[model samples]
Target: MNNSNTAFELTIVVPVFNEEDNLERVKQEFDSYLSKSPYRSKVLFVNDGSSDNSQMFIESICKSSNKYSYLQLSNNMGLSAALKAGIDYANTEFVGYIDSDLQTTPFDFDLLMEYRHDYALVTGVRQNRKDSFVKNMSSKIANGFRRYMTKDTAEDTGCPLKIMKTDYAKKIPFFTGMHRFIPALIMLQDGKIKQVPVQHFPRIAGEAKYHLFNRMIGPFKDCFAYRWMKKRYINYEIINQG
Candidate 1:
């Protein structure tokens, strides 16, 4: 349940799975970000049934400040599900996303916020990623295939630092791999997106959730699923409300 203060203009959603080692750092980074953010913003931690002590950490973090709240899923739903839940629960003009891993810093969110008014979504493209060779290669291949198939031209869909207008975000259909196609999904609704370069860091704690097979094969298959959905995707306008 959300234990928040006044309504915020932006709600930053951090999807947590089993990042027990990283929650304290997450709170610190967010505290710094929210304290200096130009727009009023708060954070929501979507704990996806963390078998570790992540839930306890989240609870303690939220209790310490009204700027934070969290939702705990019943089971270990994937990242896509966690993200969807956060978006749904957000009651703000803009919804932001960041991973708990801290590969991308929450401070870079300031860069994306610059274009928040003009674009439906502003996403970060990680600069000089600090992952292993295999992970980097698989991500490159997957990103190439996704762009080729979806033609979304999203430079780094997996960067995990994004801010999108809440209305556009809620319109996106949820799927197991919806996280990879956020730009494409927004484009399907005739929404514009801006991609900006953001700082990248090596993971200092916890384990990387993705590997070569899931990173490469999952997006490849999801690309087909996205293509199928795109062909039948619906868009409409209401010219009159009288």
Candidate 2:
């Protein structure tokens, strides 16, 4: 990794899994944001061991552009692993997470970033999700369960738009489904989290890797893991002046 002459304001991490069809659109949208947005940011594409043409597409994009770059895992490591890799490589002051499916626009980062100054983490909630009934209902059910279990109280845990300080992000313990547990994990470190409404659109291409079982059950199991971590979590603050 090349050290920047100065720290970047934000580094947006996009976890992709066989998203070949949507790759170019993601590129165009992010590229436009980098050029037109108020904040200076870099895009990191974590090609999460995609079996499709995603790896090659990412390689091409990185070769052609300096503003965008990518990292490929030896094999599939899921979203949590991809995000951990991105967070580990992050050299910016703040890091952001978004989906490559194009359902969540990167421009929404503009809104989330505005609140990052006030909170360690700023997340987005879909106002009117453009998804199927089954998809939407399943998400609601899972989110409701998550809220009841963890008491994070955010409207959308699955919304792809989030921005947070890199230092605070690094403190959260890594675990499966850690992506969805960001608010709770941040709270573990006494980090404040903010939520805001953002635009959500339907997926234009590529199949979702997660289904109801994987989305709901998988997170439910991980919620237990989170509770365990919370019980064992350690937090400390300085008591004396520097």
Candidate 3:
């Protein structure tokens, strides 16, 4: 474990996949956030084998700022894999996650941070989403179905902004769509979750990764998988240890 006094209390993982155009703005946004963050925080960019120049930009940004570091995957394993890799590498007390597209602001992390001590996970619920009709509606349908299946009670599980205790996050079982079920996974461990309203924006650069089909169908299937895992998840506490 990293010494709390010396290392950052939180590390925000920014998972990147062909986000070349968004890298510069991402650096500026996170840099500004760190300057004003209440908790000592740093950014960790996880490159999921971006085929574009995204890795170059990530390297440049990391070199220019000590607040930034990164992990590069050998191939594109998708968001869940990248997130799991980031959480596995994180050594801070708390770990945060945000998209590189900047749909959710890094500034709102303050709101989530305020409740970090009270819950295992603090996730954002985007208020007044600025996405297309299809995207928004599909997400709503998916979220509703997911809530019914998992009973996680998360209003907006698709929200990209979230803060999680490193211990709980590291314990989450990783799956193909694990990123979409963070709150549910935390709940499976008997941990609490808090959701706060946050700002949302339209994509400034690069393309949206998921479309209606994947957004809806992928989550629909994964919800069942979560149900299967929930039934068998094991939890135990040790009373004595040598």
RMSD of each: 1.2, 1.5, 1.8
- Each prediction's whole-model lDDT (CA): 0.93, 0.88, 0.92
Which has the greatest TM-score? 1
Q: For residues 5-120, write the lDDT of model 2, one tens digit per residue.
A: 17468989999899999998988898888889999898899999999999989988887766677889989989999999999888899999999998989999999988888899
**Which stretches in model 3 have alpha-carbon errors above 4 Å?**
1-5
Candidate 3 residue lDDT tens string, 1-242? 22232558888899999999999999888888888877789888999999999999999998886778899999999999999999998888999999999999999999999999999999999999999999999999999999999999999998999999999999999989989999999998889999999999999999999999999899999999999999999976579999
lDDT of 1 by residue, 1-242 (tens): 65443668889999999999999999998888888878788899999989999999999999987788999999999999999999999988999999999999988989999999999999999999999989899998999989999999899999999999999999999899989999999999999999999999999999988998899889999999999999999998789997
Higher-ranked by TM-score: 1 or 3: 1
Candidate 3, residue 99: Cα displacement in angstroms equals 0.2
The TM-score of candidate 1 is 0.97
Model 2 clashes, total count: 0
TM-score ranking of the models: 1, 3, 2
What is the Å distance of residue 58 in model 3 from its true position?
0.3
Q: Give candidate 1's error at residue 174 in angstroms.
A: 1.3
